[model samples]
Target: MMITMMKSYRGKLHLPMLAGVVCALAFLVLLYNERISFLSSTSFMRFNTCAARRAARDATDGGRAKIDDMEEEDKLEYDADICDITEGRWVYNRSIKPLYSDRSCPYLDRQVSCVKNGRPDSDYRYWQWQPDECSLPRFDPNRALRKLKGKRMLFVGDSLQRGQWQSFVCLVESIIPKDQKSMKRGRVHSVFRAKEYNATIEFYWAPFLVESNSDIRIVGDPRKRILKVDSIAKHAKNWLGVDFLLFNTYVWWMSGLKINSLWGSFANGEEGYEELDAPVAYRLGLKTWANWVDSTIDPNKTRVFFTTMSPTHMRPVEWNNKDGIKCSNETRPVKKRGHWGSGSDKRIMKVVGEVIGKMKVPITLLNVTQLSEYRVDAHTKVYTETGGKLLTDEQKADPLHHADCIHWCLPGVPDTWNQIFLAHL
Candidate 1:
């Protein structure tokens, strides 16, 4: 199973591989040049306890209990295929330092460079996700580069996806010789190149997955979002012929109770718009994306993966820290297993599962939500930037209003996400 992408590289569609090394990560890289496309959830506890719950509920009925016992028994069985990687806890391991420091990765975005942003503690980098049933392979850049040889891997959707994209780049970029590597930034798309392998790691910014007004990397009013829930071709055209596509979108859709959705083109001056409940709009948007996958992709040639919604830590009250201001000053992970925060919505996750379940294409879901929920301390908090600018000392001083609880600190949680991502490959 695999989950990710390369977008156009602006070369010809279906361009055969340039015939060298593979280095793409996340969404649409075209195979005509070998495009990689990156393409998620539940209370995990609710599923984990299914067998036990069945045993209890069926105890009174001997006939029903017998059948349920056999069926539910299958749920507890563990194989490499059935390993519940999401049902894990964060272990504080001081021995395991990050593969790349914020300083080492020149491409590290200011939004998640906590250490460079005057963060005093490095404890957050020490915790590793330990699966109760099996061990995760430690991240190896050389091996990962080999996995990506002659491939274009694409990471698509929102800034969190960008964080995961950045994590993958930082993990693999350090080893390539200076002359062999290059990074290019664009308004809607970006590519990190490794000439030695003829590989490209790329990212495309499509915040809502489907077309949206907030598709740009930076927006004037971030909260005033609008979606073209019925369309995707505007973005999906670049994803064509990608070998691996990794994708995600959720936080941006939850900005308010109602989301403004457009029916026509963004060129039509925002006409044919209507206000619908966020969930209704979300379902339509996902359906549009699903229609593209079912109609366009050939699963045998292109592996598609959708990362589950990344969790947030904005409300300290959700974790029982009544006095804490969001994730501010927090330096330790939440120890509770199956800890579901308010930041992660079960309803949205349900939509993801339902839509993916209905798709004819085989899309591997990188379920990182449950594991990340424990990393309450991993957010950039007040140390990160806003609107692409570093926060001032005065703004950082105000943790309550200024703390960024949505994005994870690099070399912190996103590295773990990439680890889970690598496991599938």
Candidate 2:
């Protein structure tokens, strides 16, 4: 059609007609290109805007997730502050593994290392402390070391406190290199130092928490445990400037129904001694210790904690086991809540409360007594020593008179005490 039109117009082709045809085609082509360029620019702007918005939204969501995690941790810490952790029950969870084994910790005393001494069963190590309202965080050894950096945590009391010290050392030292740690097992003031942290976890042998005849690291006579109910100068000198002081004096104070109390020097040949009822002597002794704490301890420098009386499972009949003797052959915890055995004196704990209650400086009490009463299975139970020596074959055969039910096994109840302790810190 264009060829026929062009042939008819070829002879009559005029300059104005040719110019008008060319101009019309040029106008149409320019308009089409301009429309395509406008659509392309619009599409690019829309894509760029959506992509930038999506990236910003993703960043905001990530930040919110991180903030939520931090808030949860803060909530846990708050709950721990409000709840009574001492009111917990012992949950026998089989999945529980000890923080450190007796074999792994060379710092363990021969007495409390029941696993290494052939206790035969490991069921006692399985009981976990579950609080009624809040759960304790799993203990972190590295964090404990950081918390105790450049500090001295001194455990002052009898052998039971010594056991707790041992458990704490094992917990933190498991992560420490051998070259960075040292143990000084002195007769009176034993020390375990982590050189990297410049921190020491020590035990000062103050059985009565005052001057006592049994303060002799190894006593010649076990029957003559006497307390000079008004003396603290000698022991308090060692306790000065300690950062964390954990004081306990229950089992050692329980010698008999009556204890010998003295008013003068032990060098005076027993001339100033009088027999007082055990509770009376205990109260007098604590008064002396509390006076020392009130006067000598600068609360700004030292944090004081008193562990409640750790119970003893001597007679199984109290737990309704007529066939058993001492804590021997026990493989499980006491099922009853608030179970108090015949061995643990509630009167002694009352004295502790009254003394600490009247103190001038603040002293937090780690009330692990009731929870510990449920753990009859955790005692050394004849796998321990009587006088710093492992029990003989003859002593092992007689579980009634030889089993050391007073001290709990390592990686056992004392670990839980340390757990509650870390929660406070």
Candidate 3:
């Protein structure tokens, strides 16, 4: 009976030992599975990070990469055909240097050559336009001049358009020999010719696009501006047979809710002006221009571009400056995203869009207003000269009096504008 009792005790001990072994095996299995899961998750996260970086590079590099290699989550859906390149943000890139400098390009107007004329800051010259989907090719003056060989290009409208024209001149002139190019200014027009290429780039001063009292070579007063809304032939006659035409008219149209439109010519002695709602008057003026293009221009031969209004940075409140502070002394662009300053008129853009939409002729709209709105620091501001005269002490003290926030600095924002324009061409 003692032997039987010992056997039972041993059996009981053996049962507990077997249970402990089973528990240890189960714990090992659980740990192994957890480690496998962790490794799989880490591998997936690494792959996703690499894919995201690749996608971003492809998006900015002109969308040349194929999407087949990308996973569903990594694929970027974009149609280059429908994408608007002008609609994008300005990214800080150290790689992109200015295409031209104020000192290098002799053709730059003094008013727009802010850096060459002794502006202190150099940061504005470095910022580049980063389109949302694709990259804009850098401005190659030789290629542009080659493309324009035997062609004539004209920029029509206000001083803002003149700024763009000057930008184009400087861009193209850099590649040409000094002796082969010539620049001449007439009463109402300025011409820059690449003699060997037989190409001409011209600017005509027509603030209203139609004949107006403000059409004089020198506009004295902003308030005294008057438009003949229905007539654009006086200016359109000068635009005929141009290989490429760029046009802009906006700041002059923003005079008031009602524009003083004259029914008769400015040369007539009789002075009677009727008030027309600004938008209505704008539409009328655009329609006249559209009619002129439709009736005269051969879409197959001529490429027309209407650069949307260039934004102005005159208002201090828009950029959170003091009441008296304008765009002067601004050293950098507005860093905020989607910054639509009060300077650009959306109503005017809508009018332009509606008018262009109805036209039978093909007119490409260089929608540059939004891109330019962020470049508040790129204007001529107080560091500019007009008519080759330095700013007097009085004008320098009063920044508001001599400050020009309308025209952009050459080798600055306008170079990017030409880049986009050339991309389309």
Candidate 4:
């Protein structure tokens, strides 16, 4: 009966399967005969057969040992020669989609929730950010929360940065129980605490990253924007000891109005205030910020990131639209490769690159500007609500009046920014 069973098994096995069985038995035999080297004298066919058999055995044995070996090999291979992940252009990938949904993420704020606020299209949510050389690992919020446990991640910048903060909060907040998370808001700062993980994700309003007239507890007007180019101590104090610090300052600098810099206190009036060129003023402000980071931050304990300027989709000419349509009603991204929209200023990006290059404490530049330039269809536009009411008909009619082409929608482009952020982390 046993012989009949063996013959039945042999008859059922294919040539490849027979080879694998022979290889498995040969491997066992060679285990005792250490002098016989299977790799040196064995033919290619025999070696591949043995490899296939070993793979099958490993798979059946749960593959933990084989996986550990491969992981160790990968560590050895990639530990010393990591590539620059952010220096890549965006590509269209149908297989990849947004990591979170606006409907599913309860932590999503109203202003940036473009889907829930009555936007009719879903195409914007399907676009993915693809790096040039390597693959960006999909965001796993549970893993992100695990890494963020007992740590603090802070985003400091203008409203664009605030939008990114909201996106990130929504991205990871779904994994935590409702009762374990809490939120607190202040004039310049808002904190989201995950009590279960002892983690806090916070946003600090520092449009210029320095003490400015616009730094008031409540900044209502962008027209009256003023920056203190030489002082950042007031805002920099709150940034110390953070595990991750993301800083951005751009749109406020590009308002085309000369910035006012104060050599004296605001209490002293405009006596020490001087008008400076925008880019020059921007350079000075960044220098002040860089100085503070260099002096205060410990490179070993903290990771610093400065996001590239977030593009605005205000001009139709920028996206080759001859009919003069803004980001209000667009439903698709720029289909061309290397589409350099007119919204981003290369001069400003140059300033950022130069300043960050000179920093002693390795600050990563999340160069998301080029990737964002194509996403003209992803802005909040007129579908957004202001003060708990939708835009009026007149407001919707005037593109320049109620259309917000500056800030992005939640579960949109900023999620890609955070996804890249997670891969690097």
Candidate 5:
């Protein structure tokens, strides 16, 4: 059976390879200069272009080029480049990391474009994606979302949770027949309804998915009391009977201070959270979240997904770039480094995996962290403005510290995130 399956797969590869070869030949003809040359100088441009398209396809399909065919050093070099963060390696699979490329996404066609100079730093703008315009082969969002209609999809976490929610929304909304779509915002939940699919996508902001001091209760004197973790049940109970529950909570816990007065404890006095360490706090929080999941969320009725931490590009030295410089103006999709593991902080990953390990429910993990760790350039601060009209000039200037270059550009990275979501769903 394995032999037969392998042959069947090999047979499948034949067509794409032949098609790629034909496309490569046509480009060679176009670059003939004066005439088609069989024995003349080489056309490096055509050669590289064909290689790029093929390489992108291979990587996107999760096929690392065969190493046995090349010399040891060359094989190693290719492996390194294909996974390079600076190269924006995720472009091969842009559905998960939308800002991986400045060029329009092949899946969505020209609907996604770079706003500022198509560099890495320019990665943070909206993609203007159109479902109808997308040319890439993909599982239909209408079909996937159809399964979720009338079902509540909740994103629970901190500000970064908003990023994934926005991404998931834009992706689903694009597929929804526009005439049938509607959105309604409430104090705790923001719902997007697609009449055509009968689906209601909602976002409920719970920085901590569990009940923590941050969500409820006041500490210190009333005059000086700062708002912190209050009540998780106030929000968590409302998300019951949900069809999809996407959870995230890292950046906010690490935010150290209040992210915004609205999402945090500003009024509560400075009896700050004693759980200062991110890992310990995360473990405890997940314990609470797990207790809730096991107690309330029914696995048969709801699909639960936990988004791994979204890495920030604030550190340039990690990517071999100079200090004070952010991920901006990077056109080429190649990383200077080879390994994704080298760039990420593994301690966090271990804690996350450990928490999930204890869960009785199967949690789908959107593990874009290591791969995203390298994409320090794909942020939107000081670039475009649509969703975030309230932030000031100063906020945009200090994106590394202020404006959220940490999140993701809507319609770009999030679209891919939705794609992954659909695949799992």
Candidate 6:
């Protein structure tokens, strides 16, 4: 009986199953070895790579510092200290007194009297985004700039929104070395974090910041729609626990009207267009945003800011005696209007201001639109990278829109935008 059982076990009947089990075991072992190798190799590679990059940057910086008569040496030290403060170290500067004289209004710009119907007084002496200073308020950068390190600041909006984000990054990075600065692109947001400042600033590309056609998805049937608010929520979570939240969304509504996307129910269960217009959509969106702010965001440690709609450059006819052209060759500052004057875009501004002002949460308004509209020539459409080179004919054929008509050239309008942001901080 034992000899017969041994013969059966060794038969072809069980050979395939036994071979399969052996192969499965081998695969798992191979997978484990590969994972271990990858983990160990990457760890070693990163350690050596970082050391090499640091050594290279230091050697190059030493020569540049010597050539510049060592001016950057002192600047570097001050910057490092400021960067350290971002890690929550409060550096008190005795020489810098309270930015405001009036206890009623803690901002110095608020005290100064300015022309009626103009930009805020706070913006004039500092950023000068608007002409008059009546409504302008300022933030003392000296007080708040270094206070944020390891904190997150987010700006949510369209292309014009990028101007503010870029400006903020440039200003902070200027104080810190480029080597210490790092940028990582996220699915919905792009993040720039400075190790020195221990600060993370991110911008989410939510032009509408509401449930719109841009965000919704249509299945096999175009008519069948789903509101994927969770898509926005994914990035919204990053806004959580953030020390400073700067939110702005407007330029995407440049169609002179907002697109209403119907998902399940319409207002009062009624469907169709005559019911909702651009302003209605905008108001509704802001209401949703405010609700999110009220629920998810905590105000005690988090400072919330909403930058007003930035002005769009549509016609060259009104820009300082120009005609029939866009902002192609514009370089000089607006000699005709200072700040956002009478000619500034009002239709969008009114809606934004009204919606934001009515919110239960107090959101700081960085009124940059009026002042920014004047710097049309500062845009970088007609040219190439950093506006260093002009656009070729081949580039014009693409549907990417004229580079000049949209995004502002870096180091130009954005620099002042940061100055404005810093002033407010």
Residue-by-residue lDDT tens digits, candidate 1, 329-387: 78888876578888888888888877877788877788888888888888999888886
**Cα lDDT computed for each candidate against the true fold:** 0.76, 0.75, 0.72, 0.72, 0.50, 0.48
lDDT of 4 by residue, 1-425 (tens): 00000112444654434545576576556446432111111111122324554355456556744422322112211110132333244455667667677788776777788888777887788877554323456778898898899999999999889888988898888778889999897778999999999999999999889888777554556446566788888888899879999999999888865777666467555455778777888899999999999898998899888888898888887678867657876878875655676678777877876776677887766767767887888898987778668777788788777898887888888988887677667
lDDT of residue 368 for candidate 5: 57
Q: Which of the two candidates, 2 or 6, achieves a greater TM-score against the reference?
A: 2
C-alpha RMSD for every candidate: 13.0, 25.7, 18.5, 14.1, 14.2, 27.3
- The numbered model that scores best in lDDT is 1
Residue-level lDDT tens digits of model 3 in 229-279: 778888788888799988899988885778877765766553677778888
By TM-score, the candidates rank as 1, 2, 3, 4, 5, 6
Candidate 2 per-residue lDDT over residues 61-123, each given as its tens digit: 663432112222222231322344544467778886888998999999888888788888988
| Poorly placed runs, candidate 6 (over 4 Å) | 1-145, 177-179, 213-235, 256-258, 263-275, 320-324, 338-344, 384-391, 394-403
Candidate 6, 316-388: lDDT as tens digits: 6666545435655454555453334332446666766666556666566665564566665555444443233
Which pairs of residues collide in candidate 2?
Answer: none
- In terms of TM-score, how similar is model 3 to the real structure? 0.78
Candidate 3 overall Cα lDDT vs. reference?
0.72
The TM-scores of all predictions, comma-separated, are 0.82, 0.80, 0.78, 0.77, 0.62, 0.57
- Candidate 2 lDDT score relative to the true structure: 0.75
Indicate the residue-level lDDT of 149 in model 4: 93
| Model 4 CA lDDT for position 168 | 88
